[model samples]
Target: MEVIIATFFYARVSTVEQSLDHQVSQANDAGFEIDEVIADHGVSGVQHILKDRPEGKRLFDKLRHGDHLVVRWVDRLGRNYEDVTDVIRHFIRSGVTIHTVINKMTFDGVTTDPVQQAVRDALIGFLAATAQAQTEANKIAQRAGIEAAKRNPKKYPGRKPSFDRLKTELVRNLINKGLGTSAVAKEVGLTRQAVLRIRDDPQGVEAALQRWDM
Candidate 1:
């Protein structure tokens, strides 16, 4: 049998400006020799399912029996409680040892002690449920705010876009010239997805640009 020992790192951030390097460095400092890292940037854990995201789905396909999956924290694995438990359980059942760099937590299926197993399972379940519930509450509040905004569009001021007019024009020009999103981000010094979003919705970009001046 292949010694199937590997450490997989998962890093996630809710915004394009957040750095994955901080999480990577933390894991490395904790003495885990990470073989590969999978990240989903500018993606919300509470709203997006692990299996639904492009990078998140890619990670699901890479894990195998005997592989070790590591994360900065339990929250890194999921946005909600149910998702955290579901993903962890799915991998644990497949013989993957889930490790968290913070507090050096480990969850695996090999525990033989009934009491310890029960305690661990209970904690996992409780935490998962809490996370999911919190996520739902956030979603509800967000929906209410959005509905209110729709009712009075002038009352809700959205997030300000960080880029300047020069960057915006360059980003759009790059796409119009047939450049890929990644390339545009590289040239304009913005995240790849941000460039794509700006290209797709010029009106939104214009709105954001207006905020930059204020």
Candidate 2:
């Protein structure tokens, strides 16, 4: 008999003092043999989507049918409600099972019972929808904070951009030189869609440059 193997993947945003080691340790303690881990440093869950993120895009290529994906939480999947649902549905259709470590919740699509399948799907949808709503609330809070900073420019100091100015310049240069968004992004260490947005909006590039003190 062939061994039916399921894979687990961990993702995390690298902080100054925290690393993927913590997440890895947690997974190991949970008895999961981690097949791979894709991480992005200085990346915000609120700012990027699954396929749009650097490490997240790799998931599409790496995950196989019958494979299980484990996340720390639904928030790790996305920052928006719709985006998270869309991503989960995509994986479900692709025959990938999703498991959340925080809640120990699992969503699988292989059930034969129609009613049971419907119930499972409905639950999955509910969780994904809730994740999206929370993400939107976070966005609202972020926007409110930005507006507050504008209201009290002296008292509310804005944050510094995580990416480097030189990197942004490189992304712009590569894009202007007729490289594809994905190509330029790979060349300059950014998301493909981010490079596309910069290419499409010169003002956006300007703002990003300013944010990075370029």
Candidate 3:
């Protein structure tokens, strides 16, 4: 009997307007016959773990033996080194084959030779650590930028709002309809934190928009 393996594509984005479909397109361009596309939109990989996220949880539950998991990179799996490695190892042990589109890396649990296994495990660790380090560097740069903006609000003025006027009004209307932050965020294609900001200070956001003529 031949074992039929299913192919899955996993993708995520941290904010609205970020291209979640690009990863799927990349996988398609690579010629993988994707059975399903599991996506977590408007969710930050840096702040949410795979098990904790809504769509991430679905991916974990749906993956099975002989399944192929494709991601744009390892960072889509988790936020830090340990989390990334642990998730990959868990799936590999369950007989899942992991592939990356960016680096063309593959990880599997079929090796019996100690030397080859050790080499593969070491490479996974190194790549995961590198992704974690990049996340940290980005956070540091963001903080520095925020501090600089605070020093001169007239010069920096912070980042423009991710949502336009129509979406901003939709967010407020959702809140007025008693929708929770997470629900509003999911509905409006914004992050939960962004929705909370809008809920907590509607006037402030409106004032900023007016000042910027947005």
Q: What would the TM-scores of all predictions be?
A: 0.62, 0.61, 0.71
Q: CA lDDT of each candidate?
A: 0.82, 0.75, 0.87
Write model 2 residue lDDT over 43-128, tens digit each, in one string: 77777877888888888888878899988777788867777778887888889998887757888778889899888878867887
Candidate 3's clash total is 0
- Cα error, residue 180 of model 2, in Å, equals 44
lDDT of 1 by residue, 36-120 (tens): 9899888888778888876888777888888998888777768777788889889888888988888898899898898988888
Between prediction 1 and prediction 3, the one with superior TM-score is 3
Rank order by TM-score, top first?
Answer: 3, 1, 2
Model 3: per-residue Cα lDDT over 1-214, one tens digit each: 8877799988887777668777788878877778998888878887888988889988778898999999999999887888899999999999999999886788999998999999999999999999899999999999998888878756666678777678888999999999989999999999988888888888978866765667
Pairs that collide in candidate 2 are 81-132
Instruction: Tell me how candidate 1 scores on lDDT.
Output: 0.82
Q: Which portions of model 1 show Cα errors greater than 4 Å?
A: 133-214
Error of 3 at 13 (Å): 1.6
Clash pairs for candidate 1: 81-128, 81-131, 81-132
In Å, residue 107's CA in model 3 sits off its true spot by 0.5
CA shift at 183, candidate 2, in angstroms?
42
The window of 10 residues in a row where model 2 has the poorest summed lDDT is 153-162
